[model samples]
Target: MNKVKILNLEIDNLSKVEFLDTLQSGVVFTPNVDHLMKLQKDPEFVQAYSVSNYKVCDSQILLLAARLLGTPIREKISGSDLLPAFYTHHQQNESIKIFLLGAREGVAAQAQQNINLKIGRNIVVGSYSPSFGFENNDLECQQIVEIINNSGATVLVIGVGAPKQEKWICKYKEQLQNIKIFMALGATIDFEAGNMKRAPKWISQIGFEWLFRLLCEPKRLWKRYLIEDIPFLLLILKQKLNLYLTKDYLKKNSKDKRHSWHTAGKY
Candidate 1:
């Protein structure tokens, strides 16, 4: 497996370029600290990630934590970067049809338009914004699934944010027969459409993109970053310590085996 388990979640250790180039048609899960934390308690989220064929690192903070834990990921292949790059390069390939799902009412449509404009091709075939808690309503979920199936889209970019987007994929991706790839893109669609801005490159590189976002949307994000996500460091440390102990155990066992072999040879 080209993966490492940190805090009991499997992370693919592939670079951004490699991940994009080889990205197959399946659930594409991008988990940051917030998501990994949620996985501890949310069986649906665990099911979502467990079934993902592509599990790329979505957070620079997560990258840093991995490096410190002795399981360095190759790179961040976040949805924010993946969505635009995928369209920019693959839009010319007519076989790859796309659908934008789960932004605000008109935002997914706006993103579809912007992407088509930027790519100079109409790769996006459909756009839909499911209402809040629409997944809770079985009829609504089936309708959304049917709309996607009828659109003839090969890819579906979902921007409903964390657990909801992931849960939607877990429950409905297999039924979306037309969709080859399902991306839980969070706010990336809004960022792509100019409805919101992503963090600056330097800020993102330094692993403070969370802070930048928190500052930008303080009311909605402050508690997430400060309270919920801060405790994630403790989780990281615990994993690191566990990894260290395991390595030490392996080394000690190997050494003991070698000594026993030498003593047997002398006898």
Candidate 2:
């Protein structure tokens, strides 16, 4: 698997079909700009990402960033698209039973029903919607593990949110002995349950899906799109100019404000 380096991570440079064919059962996490920014400071999230078997490009912004850095990715495989593709690709394979975890109350169950109906079989064997902050509760998490294990699911699709979902899977994956594949796919369960709308293909193709989402839920996403993630473009520019600091150098000098990032060595 060829990879393209973007800042602190190497994204698998595989097309949708190629990725589907290559995956045999391992951790999958889609990296976008927000995730990239988080990786810069969140040590726990970084560790979770380090355990990922496949880190694929999940944003057109990242695709453009890769192209600007002279390593163009083959495709943008967002979780919204990948989930549908996975079930469709394995429609006839009985060994691919899936368990969905996340979304609001009752949403994961609805997604299970919808996906199984679409696949014409019970490809999705179980679904659970964890309460808010459930990741912090050891007892609830244990119950969730038992529920999934008892369901005989081979694939676990968790979609609560980014670092939480990724970190939780990394922490408890071993307890669920039956799971072969673990995917931390944000908000895909909501989309699958028809609780939210996705941007049209044309908008997504033109790299405006973020803008579409911003307009749809300004109150919930304004900071992520408008304020917090504004530095991604500058970081990409630093990479293009060969001024981005290597991971070790950044760690050693992280507390030394005098070491200018603009004068840093290559990543």
Candidate 3:
């Protein structure tokens, strides 16, 4: 299981099907360009990703960048897509209990209801929507831990948002019980609950999912999509150029050495 080291993160080079087959029972981070950009400037964020058991490329932008950098990833496994696929795959596996955590209060509850109706009712055992900045409040965080633990769920889908979800899992993993899998699934819950409409498959495939999201919620997402993520493309281009130069230099060096060796032999 090799990882494609991109920027400050090492994303697992795995396709959806391959990754699903070998899902680890630990903290998982599905990082996109914005998350990766944060990893550059934020130390606590770095610490969170550092402790993550699995880092999957959840952005087509990253997937395309990896390919351009000559370290192509297997596939893009966005959280929004993974939730439904995971539920569908494990539909009959009643033993695989799930707990949904995060979102605006009652959003997770709605997600649970939607999932039960659409995906499978039996798979979701528990769900909770934590208050904003709950991670900073030890008592509130502890309560969440206890609720998820007592629910006897095997997987915990955390959507409190990045860095926070990662930091929470990284910091309080020891307190959690029964929950075997922890996934930082961003807004997958909202999408699942029918509160948000996901981009069309064609849009996602063509790498305009971000644009679709921007159009959907420009007020919340404009800064992130425009200001924050613009540099990622430049970074990717820099890596691609550096890679190209390094390979060209190596090839030239090999050719020069071969020519020198031939002249010496003739002498």
Using TM-score, give the best candidate's number: 2
Candidates in descending TM-score order = 2, 1, 3
Error of 1 at 100 (Å): 0.6
Sort the candidates on lDDT, descending order.
Answer: 2, 3, 1
Q: Rate the local accuracy (lDDT) of all candidates.
A: 0.78, 0.87, 0.79
| Clashing residue pairs found in predicted model 1 | none
Per-residue lDDT over 1-267 for candidate 2, one digit per residue giving the tens place of the 0 to 100 score: 799999889999999999999888999999999888767656567788888999988999899889889999999999999999999999999999999999999999999999999999999999999988787678999999999999999999999877788888889988989999999899899999999999999999888999998898888778888976898898889888988875753475354435322222110
* Among all candidates shown, the one with the greatest lDDT: 2
TM-score of each: 0.88, 0.92, 0.87
Off by over 4 Å in 2: 246-267
After superposing candidate 3 on the true structure, give the runs of residues whose Cα lies further than 4 Å from its correct spot: 243-267
Error of 3 at 244 (Å): 14
Task: Give candidate 3's whole-model lDDT.
Answer: 0.79
Clashes of each: 0, 0, 0
